[model samples]
Target chain A: MRLELETRGTRTDKGWRDHDGFVGPRQPGTGPRSDPRGDFPTGPEVGAAMPDLRCLTADGPAFDLHAHRAGRPAVFIFFRSAVW
Target chain B: MELQKSMRDFDAANIRVYALSYDEADALRDFRDAHGITYTLLSDPDSDAIRSFGILNTLIDPNDHPWYGIPYPGAVVVSAEGTITRKFFDNNLAVRAGPERLLWAALGEPVVEPLADQPAPLGVQVRVSLDGDHLAFTVQRDLVVRFDVPEGRHVYAAPAPQGSLAVDVTLDENDRLVQRPIVRPASEPHALAGTGESFQVHHGVFELRLPLAVNSFSRSAAPDITISGEVRWQCCDDEVCDPPASRRFELAVPVSGPPAHALRDSRAATLEPNAAAHFRRMSERRKDPG
Candidate 1:
């Protein structure tokens, strides 16, 4: 079976397992294209349109980013880990 | 945790703060209850929102990390028109932009000052606190020691075996105590600008894990023990290095007997994986001491 690994800015099928015992998917690298415009919009740039987001709140309530934003300045924080 | 404390400032500034995470609702709820977090926590178990924001951390190999889906740890300020106004992405993931930094980005200046309760010892803010809400004498505990340096200031990492003074932690010698400071090894090698001397230095806000244990206690009721220690380090900035200094801290830990049926917490937010593993090994070595 063929497996894919994304390491060192490229894709390869080198080692079966990483040092941490992880097996990556068998696929090509998904790096942003050199032609910046071709890259997927990961985040909305300054003055650019914000991406739509719909998710559940901690209380299990549906939350729409656009609805909450409501033409008001909003701050979004992405945390690394709560466990540590 | 810093965000949770200064939530009032965010609210008063007319800014709506939303916490985005890949954790499920249950885990987020547990975290909220445990930490008393009073913000809206948006759950994205599949990291859909994270990817949408282009903040998903793809550096980790998923096979090894069951909880690999995470953001790079950052904050973004968006305007009313659904456009990002300002963003802060830091190299140090452990210490991201706190309320102070975020307020700067949002308001274009420093609106809120540092809390007076946090004193700066040797021009560095040292915050020490126990991991959980309380400590139990039945098992070992962990303490989090955070050091925050001001703008343009830096602190030297622990020196080599034969090197001079650096950041170090030492507990007061006590027969009933088995304490060890589990400091993370610094791998970022920095070179002094002029002298070209290479040394490891920790900039901005960095944290240390301190492991403490209680050997024996005979108190029927809960007892409070003062854990005294000194954090020694040499502060420096781009200009010059200051004299070596030490900041003393006395943490009062309340220890009581275990409950009738105490259940282990398996949640990721409360579990320090590396520390737990190290503690397990230490316990095994103690049991098999030859």
Candidate 2:
């Protein structure tokens, strides 16, 4: 796992970079690799019941996943960020 | 985001969609208003939910500033009963699960797209089609190669009997395209009658799905990109195996514009006039909160 590289503090060459380019505290790739074999810890198993999620909505309302959806199918996504 | 484009299909299928991020709720609100995002956007500013899910990207150091506290981006599809039917967590930060793939996982079927009229090999039908009308950076869509093997016939699966070739799709070398390994259906075991040999084969109907996304760094402004590839297979029955066959395919796939995040750049901000303002506010808020 390339993730092991993260443990080596400030070891590798590539510094932080975003859309603006070459932006600090040294890391390896600074991002995920493209290999499909990377079986990163993907949370719960497929058949496992989804844990209830409690968080704030974009509108600042307290949102509860299971309660709001109420037995409906759902696609829950975890993304990097809206901001760069 | 590609999810916005597929909102209609998800709605039609009665599947609710929600995206969560570590950003503050206000930032997400601004993003939604700016991009006309129809689905729900959740906020986990403290990364509590991210940690609970066990997908928090541990790669970034504690003091990595804004890069820290982010999850390894992924999507999970929940059945009506709340079981996690499928999950797409790519190691690549740029690659994301296309909406069609999510819909397929939720629907428990292939999201079928009719292939353009083309002749098939004798007794076998091969159809290849893409899930979306266009290809975009990071958002993955399936390049589906379907095979309809005639009854009493089968195609060699991977590790095809030494000399035989497995049914597979190989895209020509293209720097613009990034592809994941082909998703093959479970191959059936075929037992030979005389020599006491057994091998894997696929009969009837099956598909080999190539999850493809455009490399964001390709930096092309063209309206369409030519995606060419070859499909090769050797069809065989109990007694006879046809010679290895291959057919080359070329598709002019339309190009989708840069993702919503790219709108923050001055050039792309023209698409949505408020993009730059929202981006400024978001970056300012997250900037070195010491």
Candidate 3:
């Protein structure tokens, strides 16, 4: 099923203004949609296709999921800390 | 005990057990050494694999800790075709996808067994509240129900001492709980307590208290304070105590006062195309084999 994965670091400006009724001037180079390409500085754009990459095994061998999947199914076990 | 026994069974079956994490190599090595972990421990420091799987959640603040901005904890069983056959996701860190269930899925089998005139202990409700650096909560009766044991059946004591059953209460963020549970042990020790205790009992009621570092709580006000946690323990009556089970629960604690002044709206920073591309590229590089 198609999933719309929200980009990791997209920010919204809903609470930008202060209580003094002063419409804060957009900072230079920080206008609405400044980076029209949707490339977020803080992190990757949400929903963008993840790039194909390889992981180096403990034995120093590199393993690529896409390459290994060469038609076979593979499980991408996601974990926060390899140490955990 | 049966669950531990089951884990031993799985270990003997030659089924692969891969424990994935975002920790650095050194840290992983240390963890393996400390736990004597026999399973595979894989590291994903860049979180590339987690993000690609569409299981990342950036909104959860890390309470200004150094180890922040990691992917949510989850497990997905992928078919031979690379499609996810079964997926388990947890925003809270303390919760984990059951290893046995995952193994069952990998083997294309149903993990849960049918109730045989006796129901397994089920955790129905959980509540967590921040008491300074400690988290206190109660597991209602319904949540602690276990199968009926015959008149003579008994189980071993929980990991804690005779009176104190140490039920390790951990946060959803997976932060190690520093505080010990305020375990109120039974007044009488089971005949089995010392001499190779086989059966234990958590009769009508029990309470647990655990300590956590205060800094784990987020300082941000707009987002509201939320706490998630899990309990891993086995319950048994007189007859039979089913296999061990782990249950996860979450609670949201609201901050009373106005928003904190230190909280800044970091949204003003513009998205940098180059930076985003760089991160994406880094992610890809980490995942690529050649």
Candidate 4:
């Protein structure tokens, strides 16, 4: 049986494993693609000013990263899903 | 919610934390309440912020339900002036920089634990320890090698002048351990008056950290894993140079299981009974192309 990988998503009998070993249907490279192997881009270079992030807070309020944190040092994380 | 465990410390240091995901606001709200996570959780369901940041995971098809709109999992540490200081992007999505690592970036110093009472040393002292109590799958912890040089003596830094060995750490061949390059403390400039030779050296108390994580494909789910490695260095004083030195280290660290959501008996599962329903809703909602 031919196994599909990467683009178009992979499906299999035992379940597909993502770059990080997250095994599940439609995975092996699901949400938060972990495989650092391929041509994946990690955001913003160091020493550059961090651009503001505009999004909705979990509380449904409109949020701006720079506005929210004020001048405090911050650790910003981009993750997969909370549901999954 | 490992971040929850250190929220007080983060707050005490005046460092704020925020995590973003493709999850909808409602889903994030449910996750926060269930997990008792006090830190901010931002919802980027449209992935606009993710795309703007140039990290949208383009490998998955845009139509992929629930998986679409996710960013390459990583962390960016920003200074109080909004300048990006350091970025932690592990090749594997399962792994993330440990809290201590991030805190170190924000606070400008390693999160040093109290020194264990080790035996007295003959010359330069070396002590190896793990940053955290256990090594959890995908969570990167540090193997910290601390050095103590005698008052007038110092250890060579990287590029130890010709014919000399620089201080370094090398882990034994282990498929279970995913490793990152060594994080060395800044070295001070040293000059030799007699020969007019100059080099970088480290004196007093300093540390070299090696960030490491255990992949999910570890051969066994054994409770404890042995991590063995070697530390090498050369020390010198103005008048005398000590012979090069090396020390082998072995640490039997405990392993933590995968994330809480994957376990039935986890505290998160007990607190969030409706997590499954929330996940189902999330899947169904994504079925509709927007």
Best by lDDT: 4
What lDDT, from 0 to 1, does candidate 4 have?
0.79
lDDT of 3 by residue, B1-290 (tens): 11222356455554444445555544455545543565556656665655555444444333312234356555565554445566555322333434444656656753223345744434322334443221221100111222222334333345544543333455555321223224334523454543665434543334344433222222333434455667655545433445655666665443333211111322311211132333344345445526
CAPRI classification of candidate 3: incorrect
Q: What's the TM-score, to 2 decimals, of chain B in model 1?
A: 0.45
How well is each residue in B262-282 modelled by candidate 1, as lDDT tens digits?
123445314333434433433
Taking every candidate in turn, the Cα RMSD to the unseen true structure, in Å, is: 14.7, 5.0, 17.6, 5.7
Candidate 3 or 1, higher lDDT: 1
Using TM-score as the measure, the top candidate is: 2
Per-candidate fnat, comma-separated: 0.57, 0.76, 0.24, 0.79
Q: What is the iRMS for every candidate structure?
A: 11.1, 4.7, 12.4, 3.7
**C-alpha positional error of residue B267 in candidate 3 after TM-score superposition, expressed in Å:** 43
For model 4, how does the per-residue alpha-carbon lDDT over B1-290 read when each residue is reduced to its tens digit?
76677788889999999999988898788889877898899998889999999988776677666676778788999999999999988656667888887888888864444356954455888899999788877788989899877778889999789999899999998867778778998899999999989999998778998988886555466888898989999988999888899999999998876566622445767766777777676667778746
lDDT of each: 0.59, 0.78, 0.39, 0.79
lDDT, candidate 2, A1-84, per-residue tens: 444432222322333332212112333355332122246778999999999877899999899999878889999999988866
Ranking by TM-score: 2, 4, 1, 3
* Quality of candidate 2 docking, DockQ: 0.44
Docking class of 2: acceptable
DockQ winner among the candidates? 4
